[model samples]
Target: MKNTYIPITMEVEKNYFETSDRMIKTLRLKFLDERFDFEPGQFCEFSILGKGEAPFGIASSPFDKAGLEFSINRAGVVTKAIHELRIGEKVGIRGPLGNYYPVKEMEGYNVVVIGGGFAFTTLRSLIEYMLNPERRGKYKSIKVIYGARNPGLLLYKDLLENWEKRDDIGTYFTIDTKVEGWNKMVGFVPTITEEVAPSPENCYAIVCGPPIMIKFTLPVLLKLGFPKDKIVTSLERRMKCGIGKCGRCNLGEFYVCNDGPVFNFEQLEKLPKEV
Candidate 1:
C-alpha cells in the first residue's frame, strides 16, 4: 500500500504572485511520476526541506494535465517559505488528501459558486472541471459570485476575464469597496450573492471564504431558498495533519481532515455549535 505519511517529490514548474500585494502566490508543480489523481476540494500537504509543511487546496482542475496548482497565502512560516520558492526547486506533496467536493452528485444540477479572497483556489478547480467540454454537458447553468477586498486582491484575473467572456457561465465579480477604474460590482461577497440571487431549484451552491464572509453569506443563501443540504462549504481551517490521525481538525464527531474540509449546511448543523 502507498504510504500516506511519506511525500513524493515534484518540481516547481511555475510560481508567481496572484495579487498585487505579493502576499499570495500561485505555484504550478510538475509531477515526476504518474500524476496524483484528485477531485476538486481536495488538499495536499506541501513540504519544503527544513521549512516544514502546510495544507493547501489543489487549485488545478482534474483535466489540467500540465501540473498541480496551489494558491498559497504568505500567512505563516511554512507559507512564507513556500512563497520564496523558485521555479525548478523540488518540493514534497503528501496527498490529494481529504474528502472532495461532490462532483459526481452535482453533475445533474445547476452550480452556483461563491468565493472570497484567496479561498477561491479550490473553487476555481471545481469551476474549471465543470467547464471542461466533456463535463459541461453534465451540468445545467453555472453561476459564480466572487469578491475580494479590492481588484488587486482578486486571484486569477486572466481566467476571470476569460470566464466573463464565456456565454456558458454567469460570472459576478465584486469588491469590498468602490475604486477608480473598477467596473465590477461594489460590495462584499454576501451582498453580491444576495444581489445575484441564484435560484436554488435543482442546484448546489458551493461557498468558500473567510469565516466572517461565510457567516453572513449562509443566511443570505438560506433566505434565497437554498436548502441546508444543497449549500456546501469547506472548513479547511486549523488542519495540521492531512489525515484523520491528528485530532486537531475535528468538528464534533467529524474530522475536517478526513470526513470533510467539505460539508453541506445540513451536516455542519449537526456538528458542535462552534462551527
Candidate 2:
C-alpha cells in the first residue's frame, strides 16, 4: 500500500460560488501509480501549502474519473486560502479517503436522497452516480429532496433544473422561507420531507447535511417505516491524517476517515452521539 501521509499535487481547473461563503472547485489530478477510482461518498484531504488541509467529500460523480470537484465552505483559514486560489494553481490532495455510500447493496432498490445547505456536495455525487446510464437500470425510483436557506444557496442549479424536467427521477427543491420569484416547494427540509412522504418499502434513504437537519430528518425516516439499515448517512468531521493515525475523528475505535464518513443508521446508533 502507498503511504497515506504524502499527497499528490493537483491543479485547480475552475471554481465558482455556490453560496455567499461556499465555493465548488474542480481539480485536474493525475494518478499514474494508483487507480483514481472512488465511491460517491468518499472524500479527499485538500491542502493549501503553508495554510492547512481539510477533509472535503468528492462532489463529482465517479463516472467523471479524470477530474475531481469539491464544495468548500469559507469558514476557516485553509478554506479562505483555497478561495483565493486562481485557475491552474496547485494544491495537495491526499485521498479519495474514507468509506463510501453502499451503492452496490442498493442495486434494484428505490433510493431517496435528502440534503440541506452546502452539505449537498456528496449527495450530488450520489445522484449523478445513480442517474448514470449504466447504473440507472440497476436502481428503481430516484427521488431527491434538496434545500437550503434560500434559492440562491442551493448547489448544482443546472443539474437540478435538468432533473426537474426529466421523468426519470423525481426532484424537489425548497428553501427555509418563502422568497419572491421562487415558485417551487417552500419549507424546511423536514417539513417538506413529511409532505412528500416517500414510501419506505424496498427503498434506501441516503441523507447528508448539517447535524441539525440529520437530527430532525431521522425521526421522519423512522416514522415512514425505514429500517435502520436501509437509512444511510454520510457524516462530516474534523479529520486530519486521512487515515486511522489521527485520533480526532474517532468514535469508540471507529475512525471516521478510515472506517467511515459513511454509515447506516443502525451503525450510527451504536456509536456515541458526539459526531
Tens-place lDDT digits, model 2, residues 1-275: 77788888777777777665355443444443445778899999889889989888888989987778887777789988987888878888888898899999999999999999888888999999999998999999999999999887888888899999989899889999988999999998988899999999999999988899989999999999999999999877787798888698888768888889899989888888786
* Per-candidate local distance difference test: 0.93, 0.86
- Cα lDDT over the full model 1: 0.93
Over 4 Å off, model 1 = none
lDDT of model 2 at position 205:
95
Model 1's number of clashes is 0
The candidate that wins on TM-score is: 1
lDDT of 1 by residue, 196-270 (tens): 989989999999999999999999999999999999999966877779998988779888999989999999998
TM-scores for every candidate against the unseen true structure? 0.98, 0.95
